[model samples]
Target: MRNSTIDLLKVLASQIIVIHHLLLYTPMSPVLQAEWPALLGLIADEGRYMVQIFLVIGGFLAAQSLLGLLGKARDVAVWPLFKKRYLRLAKPFWVAIAVAVLLGWLSSKIAMHSEISDLPTLAQLLAHVFLLHDIVGVEALSAGVWYVAIDLQLYAVLVLIAWASQKTGQLKFLEPAHALLLLASAMALASLWMWNRNAEHDEWAWYFFGAYGLGVVAHWAQRESKIVLSSLLIACVLGIAMWIEWRERLLLTGVTALLLMNSAQIERFVTLIVQGPVRWLGDISYSVFLIHYGVLVFASSVVIALGLTSVAEMLLAFVATWVVSVAAGWVLHRVVDR
Candidate 1:
């Protein structure tokens, strides 16, 4: 059964991210900016924060899926789980990369724009194939590809932690599940207090583990019916972190975690309200995330080549691009992601 609330979050966050990239990377944004600088600036500045929602949701789902394994057996099949995760993330991802590279080449021939990625060297392409583009200092063929790599890394870390917990049951006091929770919480705190504050670590999963960990904890809280304690601890930790140094991203992460902790209560209401088009959007959100950049590059290049420079024309082009992105996402979902 699909969680409507999670779908709603995915739908909203994916659209915002698409718009953020459109504004940040496309040539048409300059014309829109001239007309509504404040609005465009606000989105361009803060829209990237929506990624926190995805990170939290990723961790939440990861925990949810692993709960069965953690509950049933003394040992997790770590390699199998990791392999499944990698294939689930990488299969559609590689397809999207091919689409992006081809579109980038086509876009360049139409108009030379910074959004169009240069031809990737064989090494760079291989790095991308292994999801090591960012770690290896290779340029990504598409925007936001780094997130896919980090998502896989974070899942791997969680899987290893769970496996370790099972092995370390020698700790007479703590059960494997409890130990897993404690270790995850400790890592979250370390990330919130130390790693996340350092920009240098942004490419790594540890830097974003705070937000991701909250989701993991939230899942356990919901499952164990310890919501109050879990919520309070999360709130206090995030509050203190923010008090020391305010970050809107962290604030959003905390909010997302709280909402997810209480998702069961509101799932029915959310499902009632979020239907039809909204549901479809959420269903294809991942596809949109993977394919929108390529569509945007193609759309923008076409607009530029045709000399659509007026405010009205550019605005229309932007709308057209957004619509095409969604449509393309639906197609990708149907063909590849399903």
Candidate 2:
């Protein structure tokens, strides 16, 4: 059964991210801001941080899959898990990249927007195919692809920790799974306190592991009396990071982690909604994240081609772009993901 609250968060976050990209890539925001300044500005400025919700949710689910509902280590090989993660993330990702590249070529022939990806070179294309574009210094073929690389890296790191804890006699005081989680939490602290503060490591998993680790911890905290200790540790690390530099991402991560730990407490009315459209959107959120940039580029080109300079026309274009992104994502989810 899906947690309604988590599904609600996923649906809401995905929409915020889409709206953020729409405002960022298109010229509709200036006119919209005049009428809805706070709403537009808020979406433009703060919506991108909703990616933290994704990180948290991703980490939580990954842990559940590998570690089981009780947070115990499954007697499974890490390599199989790695392969499964790659296939799942890369399948839809490749489809989205292809869509983006095609749309990018079309956009170049018609109109140019900063958000439109140019036709990528062989090296750039291969880098993206292998999910190494950020490391190889290639410009991304689309927005939000960087998160794909980061998410894969984070999962690989967890797999390594799990494998190491089992293969070695270290952390003998706790069960092997708990020991692995402990190691992850330690690394997450280092990330929040040190590595995350440095922008040089922004492309690496460690940079985002703090929030990801919190999610993993939150999953384990369920039904455990020792969770108070884990909760305090999370609070301290996040609090100290905030004191060093106040980041909205960090604050959101802290709150999201806390909320996820208590997600079962949601009202029954909310759970009913989750089994509906919210759950559908949440299931397809990854597809939406991957392909929305391409849809945005195509929409921007149409707006430019038609000379949509009026606020009313731009508003219509904006709505159409969103609908197209979601509708296309739903189809992609069915064709590629399912």
Q: Pick the candidate with the highest TM-score.
A: 1
Model 2 lDDT per residue over 1-338, tens place: 66776888889889999999998888777778787888899899999899999899888877766566224434557788888998899999999999998988888788887777657899998998889999989999898899999999999998888777675444455666677678888988888888898989989999999989988888778535456686787888888988887777998898888778777665476787777677899888889988999988988888888888888898898998999999989988999988
> Which regions of candidate 2 fall more than 4 Å away from where they truly are?
69-73, 168-173, 223-229, 267-269
- As for candidate 1, its clashing pairs are none
| Number of clashing pairs per prediction, in order | 0, 0
User: What lDDT tens digits, residue by residue, belong to model 1 across residues 115-195?
Assistant: 887888999989989999999898888999999999999999999888888876766676778878889889999999888
Model 1 misplacement above 4 A: 170-172
Candidate 2: Cα lDDT at 286: 84
Best by lDDT: 1
lDDT of each: 0.90, 0.84
Provide the TM-score for each candidate, comma-separated.
0.97, 0.94
Q: Candidate 2, TM-score vs. the true structure?
A: 0.94
